[model samples]
Target chain A: MNRIACIISYDGTNFSGYQVQPNKRTVQLEIEQALKRVHKGQEVSVTASGRTDAGVHAKGQVIHFDSPFRIPAAQWPKALNACLPDDIRVLSARYAEKDFHARYHTTGKEYRYRVLNAEDPDVFRRHHSAHVSYALDIDKMRQAAAYLIGTHDFSAFCAANTSVIDKVRTLYAVDINVHEDELHFILRGNGFLYNMVRIIVGTLLEVGYGKRTAQSVDTALRTCKRDDAGKTAPPQGLYLWSVQYND
Target chain B: MNRIACIISYDGTNFSGYQVQPNKRTVQLEIEQALKRVHKGQEVSVTASGRTDAGVHAKGQVIHFDSPFRIPAAQWPKALNACLPDDIRVLSARYAEKDFHARYHTTGKEYRYRVLNAEDPDVFRRHHSAHVSYALDIDKMRQAAAYLIGTHDFSAFCAANTSVIDKVRTLYAVDINVHEDELHFILRGNGFLYNMVRIIVGTLLEVGYGKRTAQSVDTALRTCKRDDAGKTAPPQGLYLWSVQYND
Candidate 1:
């Protein structure tokens, strides 16, 4: 038996989320169903690096599964894609080193938030970006994001009602890039908490719109309180860009 | 009463085509319906720069109409978007000069064909691009396109059963731009025959794959027969990019 690791991409417009739940369409459930078909109705459990919220897309979401029968590493993508829905696709698949875990072996993660900063709506990109009509001050957003780099207690960025108590995380970098009327926020870090990336984007947007100050963000980090941060941004605009693993 | 010109954009996945038919959903029909709603059931007419085929998209489609009641140019987009479906959007609106017809007064037009030349399909971009698995040589495509950039009797590139027999048209420019695994063909011309762009793409793709040579394209053009050219490409990969008019 071999453990197979796969890089997956999907359009999240129709999925409830990445995690499996009862009575709702989800990425994990669909993938597991496809796996069962390939395994001749045998049950196989799959694990992802992290769970993405509803309407959140992914480019390189990594997963690992143990199969009773061996399929060629190069053919895994085509095999799985044949049984999967049109919105989900397997980008690549290969055999993993022994004792490697998708969640635990990760060294860093990256997330991106896309915003359509335009006076008129783009019909084709509506599902992929958050629409903001007013002009944004990208410089102010960059200033706010600069304070987020380095290790800190990110309690202000995490969502409430999470059972996990530890909020300390190390952020390697945060970047804001503007392309024409599209604004992209890319953040790379050691790890992220529940709703942490969304909260950070929402906070940065507030600064960009002149409603919040960069100094306020620095204070929020020091306090380690959830109430000091901005509201969580919508899930449609966010994407799990990629996950990094140790060499 | 005022004649208004509008720039429109739409996702054509659901529409049959741009023009009206006996009993099918179309972009023109939807726009006319929205116009009727704003005019209190009064009849209104809409004319486009050209009719797009089924499953074809448009980025800068131009249209004009005579309104019974005056609606300010700035408010036209908001007024129409309120009644129109989500897939179609009015990007901009302005007053049109006297005797300015969408189809008649145009000086030039631009069309784009997008192809995802990759090993795997991009799920999010499936509707907007044609996926090709085989390797394509960009240099070959450029060589083939060079022969199509001048005035010629383009009957070989036109679709069969077109009533307009005058097949001569001037192609100003043809550009091939490669972005990683995505290839774009942007062509500008004084005018185009029915399905002319799609046929050109189909023939050029053969050259790209080494199935045909650039010399064959020149021979096909000189023959001025439909059998000389390759089959027409699918409509989903095509887009009416823009229309140019006198300032």
Candidate 2:
């Protein structure tokens, strides 16, 4: 028996989410259906690195599944793609070592948020990004982001629904890039709490729009209060860019 | 009454086509419905720069309509966008000079065709582009394109369904750009025949696959026969990029 890991990408436009739901269309259910076909009528289950919210895209999501039959790892992508929907694609597949886990063995993760900061609507980017009509001060947002980097108790950036208690998380980097009329936020962290990235983005946007300051972000982190941060940004603009695992 | 010109963009995935059809959702019908609402439930019609096939997108499609009531040019877009669907957006609106026409006065047009030449599927671009599994020779396609440029009687490129008699059209440029795993073809001409751009693209794709040569395209033009060219490409890959007008 072997654990096989594969990298997959999805558009997320029409999906309920990455999780399996009874009656809803989801990325997991679609892939699982394809896996069932590949296993010749035997039901198969797949575990992903994490669950992306509804309408959140993924560029390189990692998943692992136990195979009922022997198959080459390199051919997994092609075989799975044949059975999968066009919106979901397997990019690469590889054999994992014994005791390998897709979620528990992860070392870090990276997420990106795209914002279209323009007056006129861009037809091409309607689904891929969140539109902000008001101009943003990207440099100011960068200044506020500096205080969020490194280890800290990020209770202010987390949503209220999760049952997890441990609030300490190490953020490696928080970078913002401005292109034409778009602002992209690339975040790297050891682990994120529920709604952490979106809340952080919403807070940073306050700084961009002159509603908050870098010092305010530092205070928000020190206070460990959720209300200290800005509103949670929409999930549509967020993407699970890539995942990191131990070598 | 004043002539109003507006630039609109659309996804075109759910639209039947640019023109009106019975019992079908179309770009024109949507806009006309929106226009009717803005005019207090009075029916209104709009003339477009040209008609695009079903499933074909647009970046800068122009439309002109005569106003029944006086409204500021800058206000038209905001008014219409409120009633338009999410797939369609009014980019800009302005008052047109006396007798300014969207279709008849157009000087030239530009069309773009996108092709994803890769084994791996690009989930994000699945709707906006055509996917080809085989590798393409861009240089060979470019060579074939060179023969198609300039003024020529393009009877071989027109669709068999069109009733237009004159086949002479000026091709200003034909550019093929390769980016990573995608190939983009941009074509500019004084005017286009029904399905002319798709036919040209199909012929160029044959050249890229080594099935046809540059000389074959030259002979097809000289022969002035529809059967001399290749098959018409699919509409999903094509976009009405822009329409040139005399300022």
Q: Best candidate per DockQ, number?
A: 2
Pairs of residues at least 3 apart in sequence or in different chains that clash in candidate 1 = none
lDDT of 2 at B145: 96
The alpha-carbon lDDT assigned to residue A48 of candidate 1 equals 96
Candidate 2 C-alpha lDDT tens digits along B206-244: 888888887899999999988889989888899999999
Per-prediction TM-score to the true structure, in the order listed: 0.92, 0.97
Estimate, for each residue in B1-247, the C-alpha lDDT of model 1 and write its tens digit. Answer: 7889998999887899999998999999999999999999997999999999889999999999988667678899999999999889998899888688999989999999999998788987888888888799889889889999999999999999899968999999889999878989999999999999999999988888888898889999999888888888888899999999896
lDDT of 2 by residue, A1-247 (tens): 7778999999988999999988999999999999999989788899999999889999999999998566877889989999999999999999888688989999999999999999876777878898888778878888899999999999999998888899999999999988778899999999999899999999998898888887899999999989899999988889999999987
Find the 10 residues in a row with the least total lDDT in model 2 chain B.
B66-75
The docking category that best describes candidate 2 is high
